[model samples]
Target chain A: MKTFLILGGGTGGTMVANKMSHHLDPAEWKIIVVDENENHYYQPGFLFIPFGIYSPADVVKPKRDFYPQNVEFVLSKIEMIEPDQNRVKLEKGKRTITYDTLVIATGSRIAPGETPGLLDNGWHKNVFDFYTIEGATALSRFLKFWKGGRLVLNVAEMPIKCPVAPLEFLFLADWFFHERGIRDDVEIIFATPLPGAFTKPRASSILGDMLEGKNIKIEADFNIMEVDHTQKAIRSYDEREIPFDLLVSIPTNMGSEVIERSGMGDELSFVPTDKHTLRSKKWENVWVIGDAGNTPTSKAGSVAHFMLDVIVENILRQMEGLEPLAKFDGHANCFIESGFDKGILIDFNYDVEPLPGKYPLPGFGPFSLLKESAANHWGKMTFRWVYWNMLLKGEEMPFESQMSMAGKWK
Target chain B: MTNPILENVEFDDDGFMIDPNAWTAEIGEAIAAREELPLTDRHWVVINFARQEFDANDEAPTLRRITKTTDVDTKELYKLFPGGPAKKAAMVAGLGKPTGCI
Candidate 1:
């Protein structure tokens, strides 16, 4: 049987395994998933952990629970990928495995050390990152007793995963502090590298207005240079400074180090992937998924979900000696949680920005697009269940692989 | 309008060129001049790389990507284009403005 090896076993890898398992003949092909950690995290739920909306236990499940019975799950560290010989070497005790085709889903991680003075004694004490479970939990603990000062959420660079997350954090912070009855005491600040509230113009303007409404200040065009521990400030390359009492930093995000060790990645350790094909640019037999690929689209789980069908189709075509289709159009769907039981939905692709409209059904959407509604909030909350149950199983979702402009207006 | 690169050149409100195809290396030099930065061989390396990336991807690249692919580091990017290396690099490279998503 030919082996279909998948790396990381995260959202992208697990989804690929599920979809490929159902598509490929089980008698002729054996699928294997490799990961270092046994627990699969509901990463989107991590955003709620800092606000006490989600506990640590709420977001985690054993990696074994999700994969199909036919697929093999290996728990071990990847020493290096010998892509030249079509084999991967696991850590010392685990045996090396050879594969017919490979999938790289080893996603990005926040590298706090990449920034100067960001990882000092004040790392998690005064400064925290909500991307990880530990950081979120720690911040939750610190925020409980704290009489707040300038609570700053800074995006160190762009193309970070869940780009709307920082804004959502600020929105929730506004709600969280208000709930605690310390709204008057806490001052929230949003410091981003971009010139506006978001990447695109329309979304940026709307989100900017939202920030203004929340009384959370926007420190735009703040290309962070260093964290001044002594001064308790983040200094920009342009010599601008923003002081913060509690610094929630989204540091420089990079891809898996194993890709770096194997010399298969770009400068940020991400596999250089074809934007349309989702295939590795350097290696023909290798495919890249999720945040591991250098696709210009948002590094989001929704993008990975949107990419699932395209990769599965391409893989099966290749198995039959057919040319892979240039099918993917950078479709990304995200629900931005804007606290106080309201949220916003955005549906977009490579050619389109988040336009104003109703989603999925277009005009009849329960979820409003680019505009806040209570239904969007519940949709985001309901997604946690969908993620574990249907999404991982590669069950057909209501959304299509390609974006539709049906309900959207220009 | 502060330091016009050429006559009859229409620019966007943000001061980037209206038409990317209308840009020449001479225009790039003048844009760099507008930022008070003279083109060096190193500067040409970045300009050339950013343009090549735009040709391949349609949109311009982020500062991180350019620094990663080229030998240019983050510190050097700041030294070359003092205020904002990304916007300045895209301006000098004659590519459309750099954009990214979450």
Candidate 2:
């Protein structure tokens, strides 16, 4: 029997396992999934946790819940991947497993320690992050009793998962403080390494306008060198400084350490994957999916879902002595939650930038594109249900893997 | 004057025909024409397959299902519809919008 070993039981790995299990014959193939954590987090929902929109229970479940019955699921930390020998070493008991095919889906994580003085005196107390459950929950507690001051939301670096999440947090923060009648007491500031509100120019202008309308300040092009916990300030490499009383920082997000140790990853520990095929550049038998692959796209759950369609189809094709198709177009769509029960949607691919247009249908969209609307907000909320039911099950969604321009305006 | 192709059809906000029964060969051609795609015999094959699948399943068929059942391969499907085959083809076929994670 051919052995298929998948590292990390996150969104990408779980979907691949479940979908591939249905395709490959049990008699000829053995699929095994290895993950260190027992609980699977809906990482997007992490943004809402700090605002008491979703409890910890809503965003987490047993990793086994999403796994297929035929796939063997193992809970263990991967120590290293020896690509040369097609073997993986686990941390516990020094166990090693060999496979005919390997998938690296060990997604990225926040490295708070990478930033100087980030984990010092005010680490979880005043300095916080909403990227993790612990950080979000800690911020939740801090916000409940503490009087508001300068609430600075800083992005330490680029390529963070769900790039819109920090923006969502800031928008939601506006709503949260307004509800508490403390909007006047709080001075909200958004600091990013990017020159504007977002990566895309069109969407950035709209979001920047929204921030301006909300009376929030944007600290554009601020590259942080260190977090000085002593003075409650973040110092940039260029000597620019931004002070804050309560800092919610998205620290440097890096791929799994196992990738770095295995020497199979880039400087950021992300596996160098073919942007289209999602196959590792170095190995024929190896595939990389989700945030683990250094694809030039947003590391969002939606992107993972889109990538899975291509990865699964390519894997099946390769098994049948066919060449894998380079089909993924870096299609990424995101719903930006603005304050006051409104949201905006943006859809783009490798070549096309997001434009103001209707989505799905050209003339009849209930959901507006690149504009804020209540319908888009409902779409954003409804996605949580879609993620747990249709997405994780690896069910075939009606939409194609690629982005469509038929209904969109130029 | 209104384009005769869109004369009698009831389209939703996204320009998809609300009533699948209202679709015809002319409607499909008109939808493709609006998008500046000239429908060849190959385009019809994929469009007919999408409509037939939607009729039976009550939902748009995935790209994988279309490629597996129809003569058009994945690459040819992308060539037929530049960006999104399942979605664009379905629209030209006068079908409802495809749902979930597009």
Candidate 3:
């Protein structure tokens, strides 16, 4: 029997297991999924938790809930990936599972300890991060009674998961404070390593203007040198100081520790993956997807959705002894929530910048791109249902695999 | 008065633009006061809304939608400036200083 071993039952691993289970003959092909944890988090919902927009229940689900019957769900930590032997060692079970084809979807996790003094004292106390379930839940409670002072949002380093999440938190905080009638008492500040609000030049320029409009102070090119929990301040490498009553930090993000232990990862533990094929650089039989693969795309859930078809197609090509197709074009789309029941949508790929246009059906789109409207807000809200049903089911979505350039104007 | 959103935009006494790409109420006011180029309501709004959203959120609004929701007619609202709420709003939003263009 041909063994198919899938690592990490996150978005990429789960989807592949579901899709391949139906295609491959069950008798001939045995599919096994291994992970340390049984709980699967709807990671995208983490963006809204701190804002009190989504509760923990909305994002949490059992990993076993999504695995198909044909696929073996083995809950175990990956000890190592012995690519030369075509096997993986599980720590708890102390068993070695051999595979003809191995897929790694062990996603990224937040690393706060990388920065000196970040976790020394103020962690989850005066300082909190919304990237994790625990952090968001704790921050929700902390924000509840925060009478007001300088609330500084710090983006420690780049290539973080859900790049716009920090911005969303800030906007929601504004809305939150405004709703609470304490907008007057609070001060908001954004500190980032990027020169502008975002990575893209145009988006950065626009977002920079927005920051100026809101009266939120911004400190750009501020590389964090250290955090003084006792003093309640952030010290930059350049000796610039920012004192804060509360710190909502976006700490460093790294791939699964297994990749590092296996000696197949870069400095940050992300698997060096071919941007188009989703294949591991060191081995052909091993494939990777989602935040685990070090691709130059936003580490968002939608990127995983966009990459699903490409990864599957490549795997199939390998089975048939053919060249993997160059289908994935780094398509990424996001819903940016502008306060006051309005939101903006942006869809683009590696080659194309976010342009003014409609979405889904191009001209027929009920949603407008780069335009803030109540309808966009509704669309953003409605996506939660679509994600739970359509996306997780391995069903084909209405949009194409690549980003559409239609209905966009220069 | 404690609201940083409503406080006087203290001009950079050192003439050092900490954020060269950053456009603020002071910059917007300077732009309006100079009237070197045509000023529109959309331009004002983009600067205005961006700053507001950024302050509330701690990041700026992406520029992907600057001209999408706004139009040229709203551009004419720049005439009501001088010492007006529209100008104040523009300044607060980081459009630029008023020119008494109206």
* True lDDT of residue A297, candidate 2: 88
True contacts kept of each: 0.67, 0.00, 0.00
What would the per-residue lDDT of candidate 2 be over residues B63-90, giving only the tens digit for each residue? Answer: 6568757778766777788755656888
On DockQ, the leading prediction is 1
Per-model TM-score of chain B: 0.86, 0.90, 0.36
Winner by DockQ between candidate 2 and candidate 1: 1
Give the lDDT of residue A63 in candidate 3: 85
User: Model 2, residue A293: what's the lDDT?
Assistant: 85
Candidate 1's C-alpha runs over 4 A off are A92-94, B1-23, B34-42, B48-61, B65-73
Q: How high is each candidate's TM-score? A: 0.94, 0.79, 0.79
lDDT of 3 by residue, A1-410 (tens): 99999999988888889888878899899999999999988887887887788999998889898888988999888999999899999988599999999999999999998778999777898899888999999998888888999999999877789887777677778888999999989999999867667777566676667667766778886667678988999986556799999999999888989998998886678898888899988799999888998887888888988998899889989998998986789899888776778777878777777777888877867788876778888888888888777787677888887987888766
DockQ, all models? 0.58, 0.01, 0.02
Q: Using lDDT as the measure, which candidate wins?
A: 1
Candidate 2 chain A lowest-lDDT run of ten? A358-367
Tens-digit lDDT track of model 2 for A124-223: 8999999999999999889888678999999987778888888899999999999999999999999887777888777789889999999899998676
User: What is residue A350's positional error in candidate 3, in angstroms?
Assistant: 1.4
Question: Of the candidates numbered 1 and 3, which has the greater TM-score value?
Answer: 1
DockQ of model 3, rounded to 2 decimals: 0.02
So what's the TM-score on candidate 3?
Answer: 0.79
Q: What lDDT score is found at residue A61 in candidate 3?
A: 85
RMSD of 2: 15.6
- Where model 2 places Cα greater than 4 Å from the true spot, the runs are B1-102
